[model samples]
Target: MSTPAVRIADLLEDVPTASNPPAPLPAPDPGEAPRTGGSTLNITVVWGDLTEVAADLHVTGHYQSVVPAAAELALDQAISGGSRLIIKEHTKLGWIDAQLGEVTYFPCKAGPVRSAAVVGMGPMGTLTERRALQMYASLLGEAVALGHVESMATVLIGSGTGNLAVSQAARALVRGFAGVLALLSPPTPPPRLTEVLIVEVDRLRAEQLHLALITAAESLPQLRIAPRLREESGGRLSAPSAAVYALAALARLAGPQSTPTRDGPAGTATRDGMPEGPDRPGREEALRTVLAGFDPDIQGKVREQLAHLATVDRTDLSLAVGGSVGEYDDSAQVRMSVLSGVGGLRWAALTGRATVPERLVPVDMDLLRELVNRLTEPSVEDARELPDLLSRVVVPPDFQRLLTDDARVLLELDRDTASVPWEFLAEIQHADGGRHDPLAIRTQLSRQLRTPYARVMTDALGDAPLRALVIGDPGDPEKGFQLEEARSEALAVAARLKNLGVEVSLFVGAANSREPGVDPARRLDVLRALLSGRHHIVHYCGHSDFDFSGTGRRSGWVFADGLLTAQELALLERPPLIVVANACYSALLGSATGLGRQAQPSGAADRSPWGNPQAALVPSLADEFLRLGVGHYIGAAWRIPDKQAISFAEQFYTYVFEGGPGEPAPTVGGGVRRARKGLYEQYAAGRVPPDIAPNPKRWSSWAAYQHYGDASDVLVRHDSSGTTGGS
Candidate 1:
């Protein structure tokens, strides 16, 4: 009679077993076909506990007794009285002196397998791909020598405590198995060991390994490996769905006043066909329950985005500080996470708390206030002192170390810390021992409002033509509030966007009445345009105000007719995907002039119409827009000079709409970083016009802008012809 052919297969899911202390494998069928020669060996990868797999022999790795906990320890614990039995067996057989790659076998009476083999790996944290491959090859060779071994089970050798990447470990393991198979060619009858099973407890790691094995198989066709993955129950929620759910919950928790009250059944539509607000009583709790139904780790939703950014050699460092807005407490707990990946197969995560020093405490609120005041006024002397003040106040040594050159940082802060211009935080030192550059100039850095809810949303203009609405110098020049440079900026940006195949809608104030599609910038017209949802980008170059004493109702941009408050913008049915408010104090989260006080710019009373005792600290225009589901919000943290503002807009638009060949696609964060870098370079070269940067020492307008969104967000997906250009 001929031996049965052995077949090699990789199973991506765990084998089904009946309860713990699993029953032994059923006896081989008597009516089955007799064994045949030229059979292939079967290899399976599964998501399961190693102790539960039913096999003739089990394999595990140990660190030569250097580590107390590892795969071997787990296996020992799973077997009844396994620790004492294994120790006694080893002592009796003198297997205690096993060296690296040496496997010791012992009889098993209480475990799922009839026998177990322990291989000695090197000391803890010393395992590498090469070592793992060699060890696994030796193990398989020894297992084949055991005449009665029909099946064996093992864990992913170096992926756990050994710290090897899932892909690396999987690749090494497959190659090692192949090495043993090569020794016994087709003519030689397959050994008694016809099956090997790799079990992993983590579903994600198992999935990764499944892919890696398939990838390895693609290169090794002779292996004839058939990879199979069984669908697991309870998958994760999509990023857009999770973001929408979280935002809805937040809106519900904001109280009935924030959302329109409902009179009919839940989810009923209003007169305009829009669903009633998310303000139903107990609705927030219901939403929270639904959100919890999925995996609670929200960060998993953005893994794809992080992975995409990582392809360009960028890492994401998100730091979220806990506290309410407008509360300037001495200290707050900060949660920081660093995410980076390589070759699209490996990802590294580092999570920890920000360690603040005692010497930097007692934060000088006054100094922060002065810093904002000087930056708004473009004061060179005061601006030059910012690096020292911010370093001492917020950026501690530990935090500074996290800001690596390739890091794309996002700072989520409450109102207290929000007022500080984090972009202006200087680096500790430059490689050439030159002057340190600000954080924004050195890397792609942005900020977010640290609320209990996450600010995630889907891109409204997915794969659509880029349509922009540019509103410049909305205030009439005769009224003394018009910005001449802003008028020029809007015209130039509109022309540039049009050249890049963007649908442009230009609206200039009376200052540039003849230079646009619209005669004059009107509030009603602008609102109508926004409500039409025809535009994906809104560029407002004008004056804006924030009411410190009142709610966000009074915070908005000044128009030719009146001030368009944030409350009105928030009520829009369809907000633009991106909003660029190149106006002073457009992004400020808190007031530097104290509650119930307004910081009147020198001669502001003459040029501005929106004047008053600004009320209590309220959300800025940027915050309101972001809450309204705008994908990206770019606004000024303070007053930016008109010339610098135009220059920034030009550079920013160019980076976003135009890209050179062979360069990574432009991202919102990348564009902002490039713009800032351009400005810094110009300053360094003394090329910044004197009129724009009157105080050479304070030529830091490049740091005045702030972004609030995912830095990897792509604004223009493609050009007009549907090519792969503007992604």
Candidate 2:
């Protein structure tokens, strides 16, 4: 399968250009001669017969379901065995079933072109300017893979049957071409493909196309755009130029060339092509860092910190270690970076670290499943071997060196490395026949997202009155899981927040009633509206599900209306400072074997153990919240029991609003740490509620609570006046 294109910035035009020719081609009256053309850095402008242009490959196009006149005669004769063979293939596959925005290659039989491609436009009369440009770009990529080329030629697409204005079409096409070129060659490497010759039918249209090239060249100064316009007879053709002058622009753009323009701050277009920030690393260096098994930013920071730590004598040491492992193609192998302070920081040769073992123990799934089943039960087997298995799988011997009897470490992880249950990493077995808890439980350990160093100092919401929105299940009790426990949990949290002087808005449906309350159907609209303001916190208690059938897994919350997917949530420009999703598997991400399936309408209590075999394996809402830029996110990775969740929430809020032991106004992580400790304390005391029996499994539930942002960022603060304050 082809790699998906990196996200394209929204269409833009205000890019700074290197000096272009003295004057832009004069604009043409509709259907007049082509406009004038200009030159830039690397991209050259020229107009001539496309059939006669010297290039590696030639590209043409046809509508998704319709073959226009331009592609009928000449294109048919250019391909091997003529157009009849192509027609037969299309007829057998059916037009609608054929791939869109793709190129079908045909070796040149009796033409100057070495190879030719017919790109598919969606449909006649239905193509938008954006679609046309995007398809053209994609076609170029396909042609490169087909011909293995360095140069190419083609006519302007989307201008003929699509009836696009010359100027607008040219701009779109040029942008598409420039975008591809940027992808192929950044600062790190020069492109393999060198030049693209665009042949226009008329001087007027060619000039318009050249003008667009000039604009693109200026905006993408990194690209060496040296544009020039010419006539069919090889004479210097000057005048107004049109943007829609070449079909091969995409293919040409795909050649190695870095276009340094980026969408500026706040999604605005910058006129200059230079990247933002003084510390921006070179493109090649960044790519190399990624290939070296870590995020470029994190790798740089880790390298610096490691060097410093080697000289420090501090007992508490944080670590960010990474190495190459696994297959190059798999993300799990590609991103092997792990940021951990749990049990302190280990000293290892950073270049070649151990990888997570494919399997930790010699056992069948049944045995593993049994072990999982017994985790919450009091009579659980002495699974001190759990940590041993984990250590072998992920932790290297050097990791143990960093450990102390009492180490408070924060473990940061890339998305792939985050999948491991680090909370269960510990040596339960000792020479004295005593078992140890996971390093996390033994130490003040927390998991955080691995972000750039610059963002680490970002403070939490200083908005006074700590605004909060609490939402609960709106699904029908009979059709969906009965969220009675969820509703009660929401109510309790809201009450606690309100009592603490927090501005809390509660949205929960009445128990067992299908009444309208925070309708899930309108989740997108509601979220857009709610997230628009500068709220300090957002909390939700509900069911969530994931779809894993597609290339990319999608996750959403179960609502009365529908599953509110993560894609919809991404629409918010400003997310709350802290998001506490008190839902099952809220701190997880979708995985192939995890919660990749839809939610089954089981009427289990809110705190029922997330018994689904796949539940523990997926990414949760907490991850999504963090990705969306929620300053602090708290979530549970497993099905948390109602009492435990409520207790944790109450304890967390108390820590944030009121002084706890030493911390007067605790950060979100601090609150979470306190709540988890409280749960652990309760578990150790065998203080299981009357309904549930005392078991080790009950204590293990605390491990599910996860925080995925800066640990030092306090959600709220309080002054000596005993009033809650914002921080």
Best by TM-score: 1
TM-score of each: 0.49, 0.44
How many pairs of residues collide in each model?
A: 17, 61
User: Candidate 2 on 1-727: residue-level lDDT in tens?
Assistant: 0111112221121221121111121112222222222222144555565656666777766544332233332455445342134532342234322233656665566557676666665433333465555665565555444546777776666665554655556665565555555454435354455666666655545655676666644544444545445555432222212122121121112222332222345223233222322222443454344348777787677555544443432212223332221111101101113532333222111111122221122333344334444432223344345656545444555455334323344555644334445555565355687654455544444565553321212233443456778877655455544577787788788889888877777667624463354333235444665656656677778776654544455555666555566567656566687777766533232322234343434432122233433234333455565666666667666666678888889988887666454433455555776778677766667677643454345446676666665444445444335354443
Alpha carbon lDDT of each predicted model: 0.56, 0.49
lDDT of predicted model 2:
0.49
Per-residue lDDT of model 1, residues 1-727, tens digit only: 0001111210111232111111121111212222222335677776666767788888887543322233465465455242124532342223454344667765566757568777755433345565666667778778887778998888777765454766777777766666666666677777898887777654444555666777765544335444664333223332333443344334344334233422245446532233544554565565455456557576345333433432221011122322121111111112222211121111111211112221233334455456544544345665566565556554545566655433456665443444455677665654576665665676677665544332333334445577899988886454456677778778877887787778888888853444545557877888877777778889988777654355323467766555676656655656787888777543222232232325444433212121211211122566667666676788865555666777777778887766445565566777787778777777767787777655553477677777875564556545666554454
Give the worst 10-residue stretch by lDDT in candidate 1: 1-10
Candidate 1 global lDDT: 0.56
